[model samples]
Target: MVSKVNDLDYFVAASEQEALILELNLIKRHHPRYNVRLKDDKTFPYLKIDLNEDWPRVHITRRLEEDGGRYFGPFASAKSVRQTLKLIKGIFPFRSCSKPITGTDTRACLDYDIGHCLAPCIGAVSQKEYAEVIKRVILFLEGKQERVVQQLKSKMNRAAEALDFERAVRLRDQIQAVEQVVEGQRIATTVKGEQDVIAFAGDKDQACVQVFFIRSGKLIGRESFLLQGTR
Candidate 1:
């Protein structure tokens, strides 16, 4: 007889996203043979931006917690995850360092000099403005390409009207980045839900299951699995 899930120890997260992340970690660490398909080497990475923090720096992590931070992926690999991060950071100019944003620094760091960070440590960007930038980053990650594009267009127009051509050019680049990501996704549905569309192709001995992840009406990413003992 199979043991009941309720009879086993369990941990709860604040949301389904966190719970799913936890389940993946547990399956990975334990290597339960029952989850042969999921234990494959293609461990998807995540873009973790802790909005809960005052100076949220984006990170790529495989682990998740219930700390109220926004989780982006389960991406196919580190390379692709970094590509997405690059796009967002290039446009938003968030802090790349892990240092705490205590605002006590005497001068800007190398990241600030290199145009990689907004230098929140020295008040280069106000907290409210940084929060807005982070919001845009979140929107981009959430696959709301149209919304982000519109926001950028509005900002670009304002910059141009104010004779800030340099700012307008930057906004244009940001719009393009958002659109580039959107253009690549093959729309799977018009439904409203965070769900996976699973399909498989195989024979009696083995099979490969493809999972297309859709969130907020956009296809975010996908993972495929090769499995044993297919019926």
Candidate 2:
């Protein structure tokens, strides 16, 4: 039994399950207007990639399905997912435009000028080639990083063979970027396989859990969450 701090109201339960049942029954009986979330149907957002389309686009979404396109996560934070999407757009140059680029004569967006995109919006790259980039990005999101690294290595070697030193150097830098991500993963997950490291702190009233996701011996990302009340 637990007594209210400021009122004579009291609650009692035989066990954890009974406690939950009692709490739910109380909420339903009273139908308290102060509990906003109790009547809401909202859920956290996710990252969705529509690979089935001819021109795939990655977007932050709230929908969930077992579709063909890739889905990254039910991220703990919308800000983190947005930031990650930005980084992915920068590296992979996947199109972010909502409308189809077909038959449009407009110039490339600012992202193209800054090299953040491959300019698929204006025929700078073919749909087929852009699809290839999307494939690589999907592989990366799935933690099969070696695919991208190996492709970059081949390109670097070919550039070097043709005496295109500048291009070869550029490819080398991209390869290094991929390697850095891989190394970070290795340090985060010392184990040989995919595993998640989670740590929790706090007492009965409030608590937070930090989760680190390691895939293919790499530390890809981390998230944290706070829980209110005892469970």
Could you tell me the C-alpha RMSD of candidate 2 in Å?
A: 8.6
Residues 154-188 of candidate 2 have per-residue lDDT tens digits of 98899999999976885687678777777766774
Tell me how far the alpha carbon of residue 208 in candidate 2 is from the true structure, in angstroms, after superposition. 4.6
lDDT score, residue 16, model 1? 62
Considering every candidate listed, which one attains the maximal lDDT?
Answer: 1
State the weakest 10-residue window (summed lDDT) of model 1. Answer: 1-10
Where does the lowest 10-residue lDDT sum fall in candidate 2? 35-44
What residue pairs are clashing in model 2?
185-218, 185-219
Q: Give candidate 2's error at residue 211 in angstroms.
A: 3.1
Compute each candidate's TM-score over C-alphas. 0.68, 0.70
Whole-model Cα lDDT per candidate? 0.80, 0.74
RMSD to the hidden true structure, all candidates: 5.2, 8.6
